[model samples]
Target: MNTQPTHRPVALCALIFAFLITTAAADKPTNVVLILSDDQAWTDYGFMGHPDIKTPHLDQLARESAVFRRGYVPTALCRPSLVTLLTGHYASTHGVTGNDPSPKYAPRDSEVYNQRRAKLISYLDRFETVPEALGKLGYLSHQSGKLWEGSYQNCGFTHGMTRGFPEKGGRHGDDGLKIGREGMQPINEFLDLVKEEDKPFFIWYAPFLPHTPHNPPQRLMDKYSSPDRPITVAKYYAMCDWFDETCGQLLGMIDDKGMRDNTLVVYVTDNGWIQDPKKNGYAPRSKQTPYEGGIRTPIMYRLPGKIKPTERTELVSSIDIVPTILAAAGASIPRDLPGLNLMPNLTSGDPIERDTIYGESFAHDIADVDDPEASLLFRWAIQGNYKLLLTYDGEVNRYQSTHPRTEKRPQLFDLIADPTEQTNIAAEHPDIVKRLANKINAWYPVKKRKVLTTFQ
Candidate 1:
C-alpha cells in the first residue's frame, strides 16, 4: 500500500532512469574504424586515377565518404607517419623521427637499444592519442596491425593483438601484423564483444598489406598478370586488390550489424610506396623521399547520416586524424596539438584553418628526436599549389651516407600544373623560392640548439 504512496521513491526512480538513458547515449556517439594501408601510393587506388590497379572497395568507399585527394603526412616513413596520426603531433613535436634506431644500438645486443626503444614508445604517453581520448569517453578500442608503439595497452587500447614486449621477442606488432593478411577473426570477435557490451569502439585496421614480401594468393595474382606488365607489378596490383577485398569484408560487417548509420569510417596510408619499374623493389623517390608519391595520401571520413560524401582538393595532414576523431566522439583535444579539427569541413565545405602545412623527411636512422635538423634530410613546405623541398647535404644531413637520389639543391614544384614534379622552377622564380623558404623557416625554426638524445 505504501509503495504507490511514496513520492520520494518515485522521483528517485525517475532520476535513475534519466541517468541510465544519458549514460547509454554517452556510450554511442559514433564508432570509428580507422583503416590504414601500409606503404601505398596516393595514386594507387582506382578513385585516385590508378590506370591498372583495381581497389574497387576503396573506390566505392571514396565515393561514399568525404575524400581529401591531396592529403599529406608529416613524414614519408611508416613509424613516424603513423605516430602523427595517433597523437595529432608532428614528428618534431612527438620526437619519433625514424622507423627503429640509428645504427648505434642493436636491439638484441644490449638493453641500451631496448631502453631507447622503450623511451621512444613511452613518448606516446605524453600526448592523448585518438584511442586514449575515445577510451576516456566510454569507447572500446582494438589495435589490429602495424603498431610500433610498444604495446596496445601502452597506447590505451582496451584490447589489441600486439603485446609489444621487448624482452619476450617483441619488436613491433609481433603477432598483430596478420590482421588482414591472415584473417579477420580477431576483429570480428572484438566487434561482437563491443556489441554485447553496448559501447562505441575504435578499430585500428592498419594492416601491413602490400608493404613488402609481395606475396598474394595465385587466384588474385592471375587477374593482373600479363606479358605487358611485369610479374612484380602484377603481384603488387594483386596485393592491392587483396587489401581491398579485406576492406570490403570489414565494411560489410559494419553494415550487417546495422551500425553504418552511427559508425564513422576513415581511410589513410602511413606512407606511400611505388614499386620499381625494372627491379622487384621500391623506387627511390616514391617512399622515404620528400616527394608527392611518398608523403601524399587520400584522407577520407565516412559517417552515413553525419557527413556528406564529396571530394576535397584543399590540403590536409594525417595529424588531423587525432583531433577529428576526438571532436567527433565529444572528447577534449589537447591544446598543444598542431592539427586542426576537420569537423567543420567534414560536415560542411568550410575553409581550412591554415594556409600552409610543413613537414620533414628524416633519415631512417634517427640521430635524435629532440633535434630535427640533426637527422634531417629535407625540409618541405606546401602552400597552395606550390611546394618547396630544401635538401640538406652537408654535415647536418645524415642520409648522405646512403647516397640519396634527390638533388642537393632547393626544388620547387607547382603541384597543380606540375603534379608529376618533372620540371624544377626553383631557379626560374627565385622570389617564390625565397618566400616559401622563409615560410618554412617560420613554420619550423631552423636555428641550432643543444643536443639531447631523449624525447622532449
Candidate 2:
C-alpha cells in the first residue's frame, strides 16, 4: 500500500495534459480556399430557385455555408472586380476601374499597349493582398486560375501558374486558365506540397468555366439541351453544370485529405452574366451594367464547426471577404479597408451594421490609367429596400455594340416590390432619389464625372 502511487496526483496530471492538448488544437492556424465563379448570373444556381439548372454541389455548399443571397461586387467587370477582392477596396479607391487600358493604345501589337498593360498590372504593388498579409503568419498561398495582376509571385503567392501580363498570351490567365478546364493537377500538387510542409495554405481557384465558349461535356450537354431551350441557352446551362462538378471535385479532395475541419472556404463570382437566348454572347444589362442581374451573386462562407449555416438577406459585398479571411486566421486587419470584418456575422449570426452599400461601374477600357473617375459609367447606391442608379457620361468602349447603356437619367427602384427593375420611380420618389444620390456622392466623390442629373 505504501509503494502504490497516489491516485489524486495521477488524475491531476491527466487533466493538465488534456487541457494543453485542447489549447494547442485551438491555436492551430486555419487553411483558406477561395472559389470564384467566372461569369454566372445570381439566379442560375439550383439553391437560388432555378427551375432547370442543377448545381447539386453548389447547392450542398449553400446548405453548409453562411449564404448571403443579396451579395454584390462593386464593379461588374472581371478584372477590376477580381482586383477589388484582392485589395479589399472599391474600384474607385484601388485605381483599377477597367479591364484594359484605353483602346486608344490598342491593336495588341503596339509598344504603347504593352506599356499601358504593364502599368495596369503594377497597380497591385500599392495595395497589400490577402496572400501577402497571410504570409506574415507563415502561411503558403497558391494562385491557380483567372489571375489578371501579372504572375502569382507579384500577387504574393508562394506558388502559381499565371505567367503574368507582358509575357506573350499572358493577358488574363495565360497558362493558369487550365486549372479546372484541363485538370486539377496544379491544385493537387500544391496541396501535396502543403501537406509535406505541414503548413497552412491559401488557394485561389478562379476557373474560366461558363464564361464563354460554352463547351460542356457531352453528358452534361445531353442533360441540359432540349427542344424548348435554344442550343445557346443549353450550352450555357451545361457549362454551369460542368462548373459545379469541378467545384465538387475540389471540395471532395479537401474532405478526402481530412482538411475540411480546418479549412475556411469562400465562394463568389467575379461578376454576373445573362446568356442570350438567340446568341452565344451575354445579353444587355448583364455582366457590365449596374443592374441586379449584372452585379448580384450568392456569397458563401463555410468553416466546419465554426460558421453556422444561415441565409442572410442583408446586402453584403465581396469587399467584406478579405477582412473576414484575415480575422479567421487571427491576423491583423488593415484599418484602411472599407469593408467590415464578417467574423461576428458568420460565427454568431450577427446582422451587418451598415444599411447603405455603394458601387461604381466603369468602361471596359480605361479612359485614364491614373484617374479612376475618368471611366465612370454608373455610381449606384442601395439603401434599405430602395436602389438608386445614377448614370454618368462615359465611353462603353468594346461593349458598345453588344451591351450599350441607353439610360442617361437617375433610375430608382423598390427592389422588394419589383426585383427585376421594370419600373423607375425616380420621378415619383424624388426625396428617396436625392437621399441615395447624396449618399453615393459622399461615398465616392468624383470631381471629373459628368452626372446626368443633379441630386440637389
210 Cα displacement, candidate 1 (Å): 1.3
Task: Compute the lDDT of residue 155 as modeled in candidate 2.
Answer: 91
Clash counts per candidate, in order, are 0, 0
lDDT of 1 by residue, 211-309 (tens): 777899999988999999988888889888889999999998888887787888999998888888687778767788778888999999998866888
What candidate 1 gets wrong by more than 4 Å, as runs, is 1-27, 105-108, 393-406, 449-456
Top model by TM-score, which number? 2
What TM-score number comes out for model 2?
Answer: 0.96
Whole-model lDDT, candidate 1?
0.82
- What candidate 2 gets wrong by more than 4 Å, as runs, is 1-14, 454-456
Q: Whole-model lDDT for model 2 versus the true structure?
A: 0.89
Q: Give the alpha carbon lDDT tens digit for every residue of 263-285 in model 2.
A: 99999999999999998889877
Model 2 poorest ten-residue lDDT run:
396-405
Inter-residue clash pairs, candidate 2: none
